[model samples]
Target: MHATTAIVTGKPGKARPRGGMTKKRPVDWLLLALVVVGAVLVIAPFYLVLVNSFKSPVDYATSGPLALPETLDFGGIIKFWERVNFPEKVWNSILIAGVVSVLAVVISMLNAFAIGIGRIRGRSWIVLLFLMANLLPQEALLYPLYFMFKSVGLYDNVWAVIIVFTVIQAAFGTYLLSSVYGTFPKEILEAASLDGASRWQILWRVVFPISRPTLSVLLIFFFIWTWNEFLIPLTFLASNANQTVPVAISVLQGDRLMDVTTTSASALLGIIPTLIFFLIFQRTLTRGITAGAVK
Candidate 1:
């Protein structure tokens, strides 16, 4: 009777679990949709501006906000370039931005390396001074700068704007690079030092390579800031030929403020280089900004 009465347990197989749920949450789809919508919203304005730049003034004025141009209007862009002395303005902007960015980065690297790596007695105080200098508003020093540049016969010169932009930008750049440098493993630096590597060698060979992303990011930022700077150039640069892109664009606004399309076209031209720069360094810039966010 015992052998005949075998028990038959009813346990679930691995294929048929107790709680079989294999669908994503509805909230996840909702969140993804929201993110897509937000991205579209953010991108739409830039798209409008860019597309509108290619439209004729009449087309731009009459067309729907999101409508594609029926035909390309290179004439408007050509007219804009001629009217604005676009090539000269672009050249001046490039030179100033390039020179200032390079000088700022070089100065920042040296200052950051010194303060970050060189065990100076008053390193903290030096860094604090830089922070304080960055805190000082440009407007507050404008008058003094104007007077000093005038005294030195540098007012209304490209060099004056270049020097001012470089100096002002260097403060922030130094602080940023120093923060990045501070995050580097000290043990690595010590090991390099023990291997008979000189300070310069370590900087060039060890630190610089690792810091490329941050440096590229800073370079792009400095270039954009310098290129778009208006007040400084307006104050120091008196000639159209010497004016940077921002100043040139501002002059366009003053001269043709009523002509919305021309002004918009000039604005678009001014923005092109910056957009190109971002397109070139987008990845490094993103990494640079997010470098220390996690750790």
Candidate 2:
């Protein structure tokens, strides 16, 4: 019996039936192709910008837009950096976005904690007001904000941009985070309370730790939005010294039209910080967005 069993074990197993074995599907291949195409389309422009930044004007004009630079050239970037005072502009954007993101996320978290789980009176009304604020077009409030900032003498001030951006982003942040906070574990809250934690303590120690993922998403969004914003900075930060990266880059466009290569390099430089930030926080961002979407 042992010999017979060993003989059977040495024999190769029979192949699975055609029905039992899965075959590659045409639909799966098609979906994969589509995804690849979409990725190329999204990345193509950035790749062009990166390669052409090192190209000479002659190289850019004569070669196709997608063509690689014939020779490495740091001259264009160096020239652009010097001409626009790129360091100062980059710093301006960083300062404004950093402050706005931190302030906006904190403010949003406080508001969401109050209305979401606290079940304070008129919660519906409060949520409705936030929705309304989000619904209003930026253009609709453009002139009003402009005049208000001007009247208060905050125009052309970094803090002016920080304050306005914080308020605008905080409203939207609260709207999203309210969903997350509302769905927070009741068990955890009860445990915290029974542990003799005050509402403020629970909010800071318990809720904040749990909601870190949500906060990361909101902070990234606020930073990106504020960093890329053009219209508000264009209007409010009229002075060259106070201009953010977007506004500064626009000004560079006018001054450097004769040097398109340098202009391209400048654009690439201006966006590098944002790209690095997104790449660093991308996983957390995806998780936070999907987590917040849960019912």
lDDT of 2 by residue, 1-295 (tens): 5556557897545555567867669998999999999999999878877988999888888986788888988878988888778889999999999999999999999999999989889888888898889888778877988888889988788887888889889999888778778888899999999999999999999999878888998899899999999888888888888888888788878873548678779889988989998999899899988876663
Error of 2 at 235 (Å): 0.9
Candidate 2 residue-wise lDDT at 111: 95
Q: Candidate 2, residue 259: CA error in Å?
A: 3.2
Candidate 2 Cα deviation (angstroms), residue 43: 1.6
Pairs in steric clash, model 2: none
TM-score of candidate 1 to 2 decimals: 0.82
Task: Give the number of the best model, judged by lDDT.
Answer: 2
Off by over 4 Å in 2: 1-21, 283-295
- RMSD from true fold, candidate 2: 4.2
lDDT (10s digit) by residue, model 1, range 1-295 = 2333333334433443348866668998999999999999998877776777677767876885477777777655676788779989889989999999999999999899988877567877888888898999778888999999999999888899889889988998888777777668999899999999999999999988878777887899999888888887888888777887888777777873336556657778888888898898898788877864544
Cα lDDT computed for each candidate against the true fold? 0.81, 0.86
